[model samples]
Target: MKTTLKIAGALLAGWAGLAGAQPPAGDADIRHGRYLIQTSGCNDCHTAGYMQKNGQVPEAEWLTGDAMGWQGPWGTTYAANLRLLFQQVDEQAWLARARQPMRPPMPSPSLRAMSDADLKAIYRYVRSLGVKGSPAPAYVPPGGKVATPYFDFTPKNLPPMASQR
Candidate 1:
């Protein structure tokens, strides 16, 4: 089931890329998605900026997604730009895809466990992070080059194995 979701997510992303449209649903669920992203620390992996000491949202990039500090056996998995990625999909589709298991180091299972309503809220919130111009930030030590954010977990670069239940 997890593998299927991963493949679905990849396929959805590919389809979105080909369509070149941002079709976010203009609803309250967007707010939920935003909350999920915030509390869940989605940007830590997706957005590209020098992660602050704590796990606060990267103000510069917001939810544009980025490719930094994402080193693993997956070969630098990037957090998908939720704003652009969820533009066109419906709430159910978005939730299903968003809940897809992310590669190791990402806790997609928790997201998968979210209730439909909760997931919809999160999806809506994420969709609202309209594409912006904050280019990626340079590398700063994951600890504290700036004011500490909240939760910093930059693991030593290594291959990830499937975690046993």
Candidate 2:
């Protein structure tokens, strides 16, 4: 009957659409990475004006690196431009580096604790942000200085502790 043919045609069309509707894993990974980055405070150091704007910067401008430098016994260190970093290295290399111990203020232990899948997602997401900005300033030694004012790491004088006889 005509009704049976119509139903069959509609069902076949629906099935065809479903068959071709697989979501890309890369997109899913990027979405997950975005969530992870936001929750894990990646923007705090990596994104310029993030703190000034209260984290309202556009996605395109995110992870472009900041002018603020962290100063310590190790000297001044700048936040690296993550977008450009991915362009320089492959995912495996990134994972390898992430596994290694990082310098001060970088929270290397937290990064190292991330699952490989999560790190891959982050790598994919940063790459998706597209290449932007040059590399951050190189590490400065203890006696060296940087153009930007950094958090000085000089030891503070303290009052002497009272001793019990």
Best by TM-score: 2
What's the number of clashes in each of the models?
A: 21, 0
Q: How much is 41 displaced in model 1, in angstroms?
A: 1.0
**What Cα-based lDDT does every candidate model obtain?**
0.61, 0.86
Residue 130 in candidate 2 has what lDDT? 92
Tens-digit lDDT track of model 1 for 22-82: 5545665666566677777777666655355455545556777664434433433445566
Clash pairs of candidate 2? none
Q: Report how far residue 154 has shifted in candidate 2, in Å.
A: 4.5
Model 2 weakest 10-residue run by lDDT: 19-28
Native-referenced Cα lDDT, model 1: 0.61
TM-scores for every predicted model: 0.54, 0.78
Model 2, stretches more than 4 Å misplaced?
A: 1-25, 153-165
Top model by lDDT, which number?
2
